[model samples]
Target: MNIYIIIPAHNEEDCIALMLESLVNQTLLPKKVVVVNDHSTDNTQLIIDGFSSKNNWLESISIQSSKEHIPGSKVINAFYKGFETLDKNYDIICKFDADIILPKNYLESLVALFNTDSKVGIAGGLAYINKGNQWIYETIASKNHVRGPFKAYRKECFQDIGGLKASIGWDSMDVMLAQYYGWVVKTDKLLKVKHLKPTGKTYHKSSKYLQGEALYKMRSGLPLTILSALKSAISKRSFLYFKNTVLGYIKSKNKNIEPLVTVEQGKFIRKLRWEGVRKKIKI
Candidate 1:
């Protein structure tokens, strides 16, 4: 499979080299690796250039953006910038976070899954974080859902989902949208990629509200939205997270934010959410 990987980096000098090194040593090397260095005041560009010079397939581009890292829009914008630099010849397209370390066979394994299951639209390895002396699975989200840090999309599926959304919940949105379009999204529990930094660890306080906004934008009505908010609160072990999420959803509704999915699609999403809720209750 012809795979192309894009890394959206902002002031990631500390860990970018380790990430590039992992890709460079991959058993299934990507056809191209483009790192979009988004206004890094640090030595991020230097690091990318240093590696890029050695391998012709690896390259980097510099672009300007706000210093403050806004959740959904910032990274997606960078991904698109890198996306425009490549041709439409790849079999799989990956949007990788700059802080993760992949095992040598990570891409090879995921590509195998894609080749094995023709219906599979998006597939990726699970992420693990280091704590004390060991790295364990990051259980923030379900293993069934593909984490945003390591999302790899089959070409047709990528096109079918209308690329990626700029709003929050894009990672989750992509999977739901893919399922809506009759494509399977799979995750390999065996392939545990090392996450140097976990999600939302460095995000601003205001970023928390974006989660609810995302749920609303995806047309997850009050019930599912509340359920999701509560689920998020449990995951983070904070009642405030749930409260803020509900507030965020209401705020988005008041602002009359556009929904990311169609009315029909929303119906499907709601059904899916309700089914999961029922299953959990039945258990």
Candidate 2:
């Protein structure tokens, strides 16, 4: 089956070449590889151009220029370009971040999973962050991680979900949306990809922003988003730990409560806002 690989790159001149080289070395190479240059301010375009000229195996390599200043929009814009450029006959579409090195059998494993389960909409490999850095060979969620780094989908599954969301945590969004539509989604433990850098940001802050976005989405059709997150936290003991830390606040009785406005507070407030103040009081 023919598979198309889409690599959305922005200012990745330092890492793109290595990524391209890794793709060339794939045991099961893709039918076509398209790198979307999200109006990169660096020589990323030039590098793609140089490689595309020399590699005959790399079919239909194209560069798309984006005008969107926001990173999220740039990602969606690239998907637009890919959707327009890719052949409709391909069986599968694979998405990859520009900074990862895929195992040789990565593509093969994804295809195998799709063949095994016709209902499976999306499949992803495990992500290893900074094995070369301080954290080495840490099994980063052997399964169910559903990372955006390296994943594949049946072409029909992608079409059903209407393509990438273009927002942060787009992969997870796609996974949940697919599941909501009764499509099976999973991550393979054997397939692995190595991320090159150590993340400097905090997960809690990111989670807070995601919570706010979840609230925004809940206003539409999904009333169960916050409940799902809270359920996940509680089931995993994260909420219990958090509750232990904030136990005093629960007992403190304040008749007048102020609305939250900061980023983190906004997420909490937005979640509560969606649930309504009256519903919050009942809890």
**Which one wins on lDDT?**
1
Cα distance off (Å), candidate 1, residue 128: 0.3
For each candidate, give its TM-score against the true structure.
0.98, 0.68
lDDT of 1 by residue, 56-143 (tens): 9999889999777778889999999999999999999999999999999999998998988999999999989999969988988888
lDDT of 2 by residue, 1-283 (tens): 7888888877788888888877888788788888877767898888888777877645333454644334344566676676678778788888777778888888778788888888988887777766434525434233665676677888888887777765544555566556555678877777667776433121333233343343343232233444544544675568653343233122221222222123453444344445653464586
Flag regions of model 2 displaced more than 4 Å.
57-71, 131-142, 198-211, 218-283
Find the 10 residues in a row with the least total lDDT in model 1: 199-208
- What's the CA error at residue 40 for candidate 2, in Å? 1.7
- lDDT at 91, model 1: 94
What are the clash counts of all predictions, listed in order? 0, 0
What is residue 215's positional error in candidate 2, in angstroms?
4.4
